[model samples]
Target: MTPAFPDPHPTTSTIAEVAICEVGPRDGLQVEDQIIATEDKITFIERLANAGLDTVEATSFVSPKWVPQLADSAEVFAGVRHLKRVHLPVLVPNERGLDRALAAGVESIAVFVSATESFARNNLNTGWQEALAAAERVTSVAQTSGLHVRGYVSMCFGDPWEGRVPIDDVLSVARRLFAAGCSEVSLGDTIGVASAGHVRELLGRFTAEERTRLALHAHDTYGQALANVLAGLDSGIRIFDSAAGGLGGCPFAGSATGNLATEDLVWMLEGMGIRTGVELPSLVEASSWMADLLGRASPSSVVRALSA
Candidate 1:
């Protein structure tokens, strides 16, 4: 049954507003086999901003040899730096990546840390403890430069090789990020095995005040992203990370259906009287445009339904 879409004037509430961080350009395109053009990537980001997503992750400043898709991070940032209404943050993987972001006039940067040893070695090329230390270094240096820093803790729910992950392990990494001066810590369900109860249990360990500084970066690998998001909302989380058109997965992680779709997230949030400040029709259009450019239909249920 297709639920009735929200009215033109949806219900409003003071405490029900949510912020969607669109990650199509950065997290979405980074792992794709198809290398989207620099101009198209810029336009895609601009279209997302026009759709009313105030925060769009532009691109990562990783080495071109490592992530060729976003090799032109500086050019991409230059293209959309004029959008005053939107906040575009680039991912800085290390000190070199941070240097590139600083040169690109980036105002905000995100540093990633791994929660599992396997993922840490694969993604950040170090042990989990060392990866945490590296993240701290990047966070401290980025802070010194007066740039806002957001930290990501990946593999929080489960690991492919290690099976289930412990809550204590995830908590330690998250608290390390907070202590290292990160303004917000995004808990990533990298392989997306998180259930609603698991989401509640994980978040319940944090104080209500701590929840305020947290965001959920969910994946639909197990079709639980939306449910997990609802659970997070119930626990007082305000920020959510998603990609437009459901377009990305980690190249290091062996999962295909990763990244929750921005359209889907906006649809659920707006319909439930939680304002996401995005135009669903416009967002769907943007994702469809990118899907066409990529020569594949979007995997997003909302995008598929609306684009149908």
Candidate 2:
């Protein structure tokens, strides 16, 4: 039998509450071979909202030349009406991306910078210092425009070019992002090479208060996403980024899958009696719909088993 859905109002405490930022539409759809209808994208977001996810990374405002998948971002934004309580954040890689997102009336935006110099040079085509400078400029403009900006630190676990990222390097980048006015810095395992032990060792450098300002953005390429998440939770990190149906991959990193599936994360959290406030069955249903629309299989085992 399928596991019972989590209670709507459970009076529980020991289990920590985590903010699951669903990146299904933006990260998930961008890597697909087929283009989902604009109305379908809106339907996906609506279903996510109905599943009790308060913060959803709705879309990216990149140029159509780069990612034609999210070229319909403006139209999708106009169509998907979110609850006042829900936060619909979009990815804005630079000033131009921010401009488009602003025009679309996006309330929040995410800016990213790589931790290692090689990754920065290869992925962003800019040096580490230049990328930081660029992010500073974008963050300033976003703040002035009354948009809440979040920063992402890619290759926090390990760089494909350079191996074993130092703890000081990760902390320095995160501190810089925090100082640059980004509210939260999401540490990304861009290649999905992190182990639970590695997570504990790396996160040990930050204190409880410092950890609160961090978010975990992990890939499931090596199938260690859940274990890393549990380690992050132990370290006091409460926010995580996940894609629905596991529909994402780093165009820059070969063999890297998308961030962990939101469905799988919800299933694990609910099973552990952790309160995410996300309705798993409804959320999984949305993932199933999106997977069917894309004509591809889902990357989430929980979605497959539950839907079966």
Give the per-residue lDDT digits (tens) of candidate 2, residues 199-224: 89888887777788899998998999
Residues 118-178, candidate 1: write the lDDT tens digits: 9888877889999889889999999999999999999999988787889999999999999
Model 2: residues with Cα > 4 Å off, grouped in runs: 1-13
Q: Please list the Cα RMSD from the true structure of every candidate, rounded to 1 decimal place.
A: 2.6, 2.5
Off by over 4 Å in 1: 1-15
After best superposition, candidate 2 residue 230: deviation in angstroms?
A: 0.8
Q: Which residue pairs clash within candidate 1?
A: none
The alpha-carbon deviation from the true structure for residue 49 of candidate 1, after best TM-score superposition, in angstroms, is 0.3
**Predictions in order: lDDT:** 0.90, 0.86
lDDT at position 243, candidate 1: 97
